[model samples]
Structures are given as structure tokens and as C-alpha cells.
Target: MGKVTGFLEFQRLQEAAEAPANRLKHYKEFVLHLTDDQARQQGARCMDCGIPFCNTACPVNNIIPDWNDLVYRQDWSRALDVLHSTNNFPEFTGRVCPAPCEAACTLNINDAPVGIKSIEHAIIDKGWQEGWVKPQVPRIKTGKSVAVVGSGPSGLACAQQLARAGHAVTVFEKSDRIGGLLRYGIPDFKMEKSHIDRRVSQMELEGVAFRTSTFVGSAEDAALFGQGLSTVTPAQLEAEFDAVVIAGGSEAPRDLNIPGRELQGVHFAMDFLRQQNKVVAGDKLPGQTTAAGKKVVVIGGGDTGSDCVGTSNRQGAKSVVQFELMPQPPEVENRELTWPYWPARLRTSSSHEEGCDRDWGVTTKSFKGKNGKLTALECARVEWVRDEATGQMKMNEIEGSVFDVPADLVFFAMGFVSPVQKVLDAFGVERDGRGNARANTDDYRTNRDKVFAAGDMRRGQSLVVWAIREGRQCAASVDAWLMGSTTLPR
Candidate 1:
């Protein structure tokens, strides 16, 4: 850890951000990384807990204590090494991750946790600025080729690891550019695309090839993916590469099939988000979906919904209202009961702070519109009651609580169900009960031979950290299968 008595001397510090009024004017990262002295103080606050629960809490099992100590000692190079050893992309996680590791910190049982995320953010940003982040090209080539489908975090992490292990790797992306959802779904205000571009360049130097606008599907499913995507049959990939990895995201969003879901102004949150991201990337999207001058109603209270709020506010929406099916949680968690676990509590994002009216236990009954264009939403209050036999909370509509929310545009952000079936169908891969690629974390292997699945495709919707963890483990498994043994860490 850091200092022996550091926990008593320092307080948790959040990364500074541009004021909401100013930052909302444009789509760019507003949060600034911590200064060297600020990061040192944050790192010094890491307690020397004998049994560090942050390790297990983190999906990648990062050695938090080691890095915290390294950073406190001002050994930035070693701190960067410790960070890169576990997380392939710290900049991504440092920016977007919810930081569950901090919640599980020993100091958090009483006082605020160490500013682990800010320190990590500072370390990576400094590494890049100092040119310590570079390509780790392997000494010898394995001569075996692996094809990775989808260029999201999981696919990218797996490809990078495999390439570093001397295997030839090619990443196929269906979008016009690399960085799958990272390049589109996430708003630029949260993380700019330059981070991904630089990493892509580094991966190239390390011998990882990237193919964009290429879909891994048959002609029959060609019309389903997109308009201008070039189709590549799964048969072609099997014949060309020794192994294949499916690391695509859970693209099938859980839709709200309300009475008037087909209203013109109603759309999936991802559809709305992707269009804006594309526009931000300098692409011209005719009739682009925007929240400008509209009363926006976002259904669902997850990260996607928060993003919709942020994007809507930035686009100058008349008003933004968010509805959540679940009831509100406690403002503060009971640490004695929930220590070392992700507790249910209120989490307000920077987007929520900018401007938004949020409601809980509200259910949308129908979409109200005029001329097939959304105009308002019919909603009802709900109460969660415990079932007598099942002992599970069940939502019941509250009578006479019906209300109308005026809206010009509505977005459904109810999260995703599973990966798109077209790719799995193309590969003839078996799916689990939940429609996810049937693969155990043990080996990250699907039913089909020479094929593996990781990330959301294998585990359904999950955190970015989990996706990276799965990607690394899957690469190790692939390495072990190719060679009798391997040195790659899981």
C-alpha cells in the first residue's frame, strides 16, 4: 500500500470537470486528469489493508495496492506497468468505469475510499504524455492466424494480447471505422475517439490488422446488419484462419413494446446515440436524430439513459425527463451489511447534474402521438410488492395515478438482451438459455471447434472491465490450445 497512516490524513478527490454550462456547448471530454501532486496525495490515501478486497472486486483483478504504492513513491513508469499488466486500456476504464473497486475499499467501510479511479486516470494520462505507452511488438511470429469478430473492447483486448503472444490477429469491424461501440455508442463528452485511434495505431505496430465496414455474416443476413456493410461469410473466416473469437457486443436492446412503439419520433437509445456519435466523428447523416428543441422523455434509468440525458441536454432539448421502473434506492448504503459488495443506492451522474427530471417506479402505459409522430407519453405510478410464494418483488400499477408527460421525442434505454443472432447464426454456434453464445468462462469456447466467444456475446450485457477480463482469459485459453502450454496471464 502507500503510507502507513495515510487513510487518516487525506480525503477522496474527484477529477475536476468543466462546468456544466460550458461543457454542454460541445461534445468533448470535460473531466481533467488529476495533477501530479493531487494524484500523489490520492495514492497515499490507499490503506495497507492486509486482505485487499479491491482486487477481487475489480473484474481484471488489478493489483491496486502495488500501483497505489508505486504512484505514491513517484515511480510513474512502474505504476504504468502495473496498470497495463492487468488492464489493456486504462484510459477507457479510467474514464467510463463505475469504479466498484473503490466501493469495496477497506477505508470505505468508514470514511470515503481512496481516489483509486482518479489516480489510475492520472497514471495513464501521464504515461501517454511522457511517451511511455508504446507498441510491444513480439520478437517472433507463431505463424498461426486468428480472426476476431467485432472491434469492441473485448475484441480489441483479445487481439492485442494474442498479437503480443506472437500470433497473427485480424479484427473485423462492421462499422465504417474501428472501436465498435467505443467509436459510436459512448458520447465523445465522456471519452474522445482519439484515445481509441492511438491505441489502434499502437496495435497496428504490434502486428494486429484491422478491417472495417466488414460484416461477418451471410448474404441472407446482409440486409439485417446495415446498409453499406460488406458481407463476409462465416465459412470464409473458418477457412482463412486457424481460430476465431466472437467479441461483439449485446446489440439486441431490450425494447419497450408499448401501445404506440411505432411512433415516428420514438427510437431505441442506441440508434439515437450512434447517429450523434457518427455526426461528431464528422460523418454526414441525413435526417440525423437529435434532441434539439424537443421535450425528450427517456425510458429506463441505466447508463444508457444517463447518456441520453447528457446528449439531449447538450443538443439543447426543451426539457428532459427520465423514468425508471425500479423504485428509488437509499441515498447512502449500510456499509456494515453491504461492505465489499455493490450495494443498491442512488447514483447520480454528471449528466443528471447538468439538467434532468428523474422519476422512479413509473411505468409508461402507451405512447401518445399525432400524425404518427410522438407528442406525449401516458404513464402510471407503480409499487413493488413482495409475492407471497415466490418471495420476489412484483410491480403493481397504482390505480388513479395515471399521468401524461408531454414529449416530442422518446428513447428506450432498457439495456440489451443479448448479442445479435445473425453473427452467431452465421458461425453456426450454439447459444445458451439466455440466447448468449454457449461458452463457459473456463475455456471461453463455444460448441463449435476452433471458435471462442467472450464479452457480451458470451456473457450477455456486462461491464467493460468484465469484457476486458474475459478477453484476456480467452486469449490465454487460445494460446494454451495452440501451444501445449502458454505464458499469457489469465
Candidate 2:
């Protein structure tokens, strides 16, 4: 601990966001960063807890105390090293991660926890500004070739680690560009693509090769799943690469199976998001759909749904409404009982502040449309009650609460179900009951000997930090399996 009483002296300070009025006009990052002195003060707030539970709470297990001490001492260079040791992409996580580490902070028991995410953001941004971030080329080449399927955070992290471990690593992405979901699915306003571009440049300097628009499966396989992409047979990858890692993300979005699903102007959230991302990258779509002048309704009250609200607002929608199936949570958690643990409470995002009508305990009954275009949504408010016999909770629709809402466009943001079955089927990998690629967290090896899996593809859809952690550990497992020994850290 740098300062024993620092936590008592300083209060948590987070980054400021742009004013809702000014930010809605553009699709750019609107977060205002803390100054150097403020960042240092926040870093010093790390308590002298005997055990650092914050580290464990972080997916990559970042050395929080060490970096906090370094920042407190004003040693920027060393802090960056410690920060990068665990997280290869702190910029990504610092901006987007929900900071479960803060929830697990010891200081959070009573007082406000340290602004760990803000400190991380400051350190990484400083690292880049000071030219401290550079390529770590391996001293020796192992003369091994590895193929990493997908170039999202997991695939990119795994490929970088393997390449640094002296193996020739090649990453395959089905998109026209690298960064599977990061390049496409996420909106540019959240995280600019430039972050991914620079990392790609650094990875290339470390001897990792990237191949875009190369799908690793047969045409029949692609057609079976209707995954629109050119297919490269699995046998070809097996022949060319010594070992294969499947890091393709979970792309199977949970669909709404209610009537009128096939109506026009109704779309999955990803499709709407990905297209906007592409547009931001200067790619033009002739018939691209826009929410401009339309009354938009977004179903699902998660991050993705928030993103839709933000995007629709930016696109100049007439009105925006969000629906949540579950009952509305309390604005504040009972800290006495939920201290040091992530509490289930109401979360209002920046997008919500921009302007949105949010409803909870509501379920969509059906879509009402005419001439193939959606016009309205039939919905109902429901109540959750305990069953007398089963003693389980059940949702019961209130008979008179049924209603209709005008909806020119509807977006389903209900989250992902599992990884696409095409690639898994190509490798003949077994799946769990949840349809996630079945692989132990310890080794990450699939049923096929030379095939391995990681990230959202192996585990279900999760945070970017979790994907990076899985990728790094999977690399260590692959390294040990290939060379009979591994010096790489998990």
C-alpha cells in the first residue's frame, strides 16, 4: 500500500461524460478523462488490505495493488508494465468493463471504492502517449505454425501470446477486416476502431499474421447454417496449421419467436449495430435502414439495448422506448448485505440520459404490421409471484394490462444464445447443454486432439476481459501441449 490512510482522504472520482445535448449530435467518444493529479490521487486510494480481492475479481487478474502503489509513487513506466502483464488490452477493458473489481474492493465495505477502471484508463492512455507500448518480439522462433480462427479479443489475445512464445501464428477472420466483433458488432462511439488498428499493427510486428475474409468451414457447412461467408474447408486448416484454436464468438442471437417475426423493419440488434459500425468506417450501404423519423422500440434492457437507444437517438428517431421483461430493480442496493459483491440494482446508462422511455415487467406478445412493415407491438405488463406448490417464482400476465405501442422499427437485443454451430460442426466438437463449445476451463481443449476453443465460443457470451483471460490461458495450454513445457503465464 502506498498510503495507509489514502482511502480516508480521497473520494472516488470517475470520468466525466459529455453533455447529453452536445453528445447526441455525433458518434464519438464523449468521456472526459481525469487529470494526472486526480488520477494519482484516485490510485492512492487503494487500501492496504492484506488480501487484494480486486485482483481476483478482475478476469485477467491485473496486479491492482502493485500498479496502485506505482501510481501513488508517480512511477508511470513500471505501472504500465504491471498493467500489461495481465491485460494485453487495458484500453478496451478500461473503457467497457463493468469494473466488478470495484465491487469486490475491500474499501467498498463502507466508503466508496477506488476508481480502479479510471486509473487503468489513465495508465494505458499515458503508456500510449509516452510511447511505452511497443512490440515484444520473441527472442527465438519455435518453428511451429498455429491457426487462430476469429480475430476478436480472444483470438487476437491468443494469437499474440502464441506468436510471442516463438510460434508462427496466423489469425483468420471471416469479415473484410480483422477484429471479429470488436470491428463490427460494437458501435464506434463506445470504442473507436483505432484502438484495434494499433493493436493489430503491434501484433504484426510480433510476427502474427492475419487473413481476412477467410472462413474455416465447407460450403455445405456454411449453407447448412446460412452463415453468409466464403468457406475454407476444415481439412485445409488441419493440413496447413500444426494446431488450431477456435476463438469464433457466440454469434447465435436469441430470437423472438412470436408472430410477425418475419415482418420488415424488425431486426436483430447486432445486424443494426454492425451496419452502423460499418457506416462509421466509411463503408456505404445502398439500402441501409435508418431509425430517422421512426418511432423505435427496443426490447431487452441490457447493454445492447442501451446501445440501440443511443444509436436510434443519434439516427434521429421520432421516439425511443426500451422494454425489460423482469421487474424494475431498486435504484440503490442494500450495501450492508451486498457489500464487496456485485449487487443487482437499477442501472441507468448514458444512453438512458439522452432520452428514452423505459418500461419493466413487460413482455412482447406479437408484432402488428401492414404491407410487410412493422407498425406496432402488442405487449403486456406481468407480475412475478411465488407458486404455492412448487415454491418457485412464475410470471403471470395481468389480463387488463395488455396494450399496443406504436413501433415503426423494433430491435431485439435479447442477448446471444450460443456460438454458431457451423464451425463447431466442421471440427466435430461436442457442445454443452447450453450449446456452448464444451471444453474444460483448465485446458480449453476440445474432443479433437489438435483442436482447442476459447472465448465466447467455448464459454457463453461474456465480457471482453473474460475473453482475453480465456485466450491467454488457452495459449499457455496450447504451448505446453506443443513444446512439452510452457513458461507462459496464465
Candidate 3:
């Protein structure tokens, strides 16, 4: 530790956010990062807890204490090195990760925990500003060719690691651009696309080839292989590469099976979000739908739904309403019982602060519309209770709580069910009970030999941090399988 009594001397400080009125006008990230001195003070608050649970709590298992100590000692260069050792994309996680590490902090038991996320944000931003972040091109070529499907966080991380290991790596992306969800599903106000652009450049410099608009296992490409893949057809990817890794994210959205689902104005949240992202990227849409002057109703109250609310507000929607099936959670958790674990409690995002009417313990029954366009949603309040015998929670509709809310546009942000079956079926990969790609977390190998799966495709919908972690570990597994040994960190 830099200072024995540093924790006692410094108070926790978080990054500031732009004011609502000023920030709502634009779709740019508005988080104000800490100055160097303030970041050091925040880093000093990392108590010398003997256990260092924050490290384990982090998805990428970042060495939080080491970086915090380094930052506190004003060693910026060493801090960036330590920060980047485990996690490939600190900048992304620093901005959007829920920061479970903070909750696990020992100081969180009685006081504010260390602002580890902000400190990381500072370290990475400083690294970029100082031109310390650069491609680490491998010195020797291994000549082992690897093909990674999907260009999301998982695939990108895997490709980068494999490239640095001196393997010939090619990343295939179905979209026109590299980043999957990060470049589309996420709103710009949360994280700009420039971060992904820079990483893409770095990966290219490190000898990782990116092939955008290349669908590896599309129906047209099925004739290329002899033995077929279980999740993707074997013929499609067989002769092109020595090893194939599937890092495609979960894209099968959970649908609300209700009346008027076919209405023109109703759309999946991702469709709307992706379109907006494309527009921001300078792609013109002739008939793009806008929320302006429309009464928008967003289903699901998770982060995706919150993103919809923010986007709707930015589009000048007449009104925005969000609904959740579960009952509202407490504003604060019972910390004594939930400390050192991610607590289940209410979370209000910046989008919610922009403007929204939130309702919980409610379910939409049907959609009503005119001329094939959605106009209103019929919904009812529900109550949940525990069953005496089974001890399972059950929901029942309230007898007199049914009502209709006007909705000119409806966005379903209910989250994904699994990876699209077409891709998995094309390869013939086996699935678990949840319809996710069935692969072992320990080795990341699928049922098919020479093929592996990771990220949301294997674990279901999860955080970017988890995706990156899976990618890194999966790369190590693949490398070990290819060479019979590997030096890559898990």
C-alpha cells in the first residue's frame, strides 16, 4: 500500500455527471472524470483489507488493490499496466459496469467504498491521453490460424489475445461494423462508439484481421465443409481455419405474446436502438421511425428499457412510460445481509432521471390500435405471494386493476431468450435447458471438436465485463488446445 493511513485520510469521490437539462440535449457521454489528485484520493480510500474481495468480485478479476495503490502513490503508468493486465477493455467497463467490486469492498460495510470504477476510468483515459495505449504486436508468428465468429466484446477480446500470442486471427462480424451490441444496442449517451473504433485500430495493428459483413455460417456458405458443425454447419468454417471460436452474442429476444403484437408501431427495443446507432454513424434511413411527438410505452424496467426511455426522450417523445412485471424493489438494500454480494434493490439510471413514468408489478394484457398501428396498451396490476406448500412465488392479477394506457409507440426491452436458433442449428451445437450454447465454463469447448463457444452465446445475456472475461479465458483454452500448452492468462 502507498500510505498506511491513506484510507483514514481520504473520503470516497465519484465521477460527476452532467446536469439533466444540459445533457438531455445531446446523445454524448456526460460523465465528468476525476482530476489526477482527486483520483489519487479516491484510490487512497481502498482499505488494506487482507482478503481483497474486490478482485474476485470483479468479472475480469482485476487487480484492484494493486492499481489503487499505484494510483494513490501517483504512479499513473504502473496503474494503467495493472489495470489492463486482466481486463482488455477497462474503458468500457469503467463507464458502464455495475461495479460489483465496489459492493464487495470491506469499507462498504460501514462507509462509502473506494471509487474503483472512477479510478479505472481515470487511469485508462490518462493512458489514452498520454499515448501510452498502443498495439503490442507479437514478435514471432505461430502460423496457427484461428477464426472467431462475432465481433462483440467477447470475440474482440479473444482475437486480440490470440493475435498477441502470434497466431493468425480473423474476426468475422455479421454487421457492417465490428462491435456487435456495443456498437448498436447501447445508446451513445452511455458510451460513444469512438472507444470501439480506437480498439479496432489497435487490434488491426496487432495483426488481428477483421472481416465485417461476413456471415461465417450463413445458408449460402454451408457447402464449404465436409463434417458439419453442431451449432454452425461444419462445412462453412472447416477448411478456412485451424480452430473456430463462436463468440456470437445472444440475439433471440424474449417476445411478449399478446394481442396486437403485430401492430406497426410496436418494435423490439434493439431494432429501435440499432437504427438510432446507425443514424449516429451517418447511415441514412429513408423511413426511420422516430419517437418524436409519440406517446412511447417501454416494456421491461431493466437497463435495456432504461435505454429506450433515454432514447425516446432524446427523440422528443410526447410521453415515456416504463413497466416491470416484478414488484418495485426497495430504494436501498439490507446491506448487512447482502454485503459482499450484488444486492437486489432498485436502480435508477440517468435515463430515468431524464423523464419517465415507472410502474411495477404490472403486465400488459393486450395492445389496441387503429389502421394496423399501435395506439394503447391494456394492462393490469398484479400481486405476488409465496405458495405455502411449494414455497414458490406466484403472481395473480388484481380484480379491479385493469386499465389502458395510450401508446403511440411500444418498445419491448424484455431482454434476450438465447442465441438465435438459426446460427446454432446451422452448426448443430447442443443447447442447455435455457436454449443457450452448451459449453463448459472451465474449458470453453463445445460438443464439437475444434470448436468453442463463449460470451452471451454460452452464458446467456450478461455484462460486457463478463463477456470479456469469457473471451480471454476461452482464448487461453483454444490456445492450449492448439499448441498443447498456453501462456495466456485466464
Write down the lDDT of every candidate, Cα atoms only: 0.93, 0.91, 0.90
- Across 1-490, the per-residue lDDT of candidate 3 in tens digits comes to 7776777887887689999888888899999779999998888788788999999999999999999999988899999999999999998998889899999998888888889999999999999999999999999999899999899999999999999999999887778888999999899999999999999999999999987766666545433322232223456575778898989988888999899999989999998999899998899988888999999999999989999999999989999999999999999888899999998899999999999999999999999999998989999999999999999999999999999999999999999999767667767789999998899988999888778999998999999999999999999999999899999999
Cα lDDT over the full model 3: 0.90
Residues 1-490 of candidate 1 have per-residue lDDT tens digits of 6588888888888889999999999999999999988888889998889999999999999899999999999999999999999999999999999999999999999999988888989999999999999999999999999999989999999999999999999999988899888888899999999999999999999999999988899765767767877888888898999999999999999988889889999999999999999999999989999899999999999999999999999999999999999999999999999999998999999999999999999999999989999999999999999999999999999999999999999999999998989899889999999889999988999989999999999999988888899999999999888877889999
In TM-score terms, which candidate is top? 1
| Candidate numbers sorted by lDDT from highest down | 1, 2, 3
**Sort by TM-score, top down from the best:** 1, 2, 3
lDDT head-to-head 1 vs 3, winner: 1
**Residue 467, candidate 3: how far off, in angstroms?**
0.2
Highest lDDT model number: 1
lDDT of 2 by residue, 1-490 (tens): 7788899888889798889999999989888567788888998899879899898999899999999889988899999999999999999998888899998899888888889999999899899999999999999999999999999999999999999999999998888889888888777788889999999999999999998877788776556533566777778888988899999988989999999999998999988998898899999988787899999999999989999999999999999999999999999788888866788899999899999999999999999999998999999999999999999999999989999999999999999999878788888899999888899988899998788999999998998999999999999999999999999999
| Global fold similarity of model 2 (TM-score) | 0.97
TM-score of each: 0.99, 0.97, 0.96
Candidate that beats the other on TM-score, 1 or 3, i.e. the better one: 1
Clashing pairs in 2: none
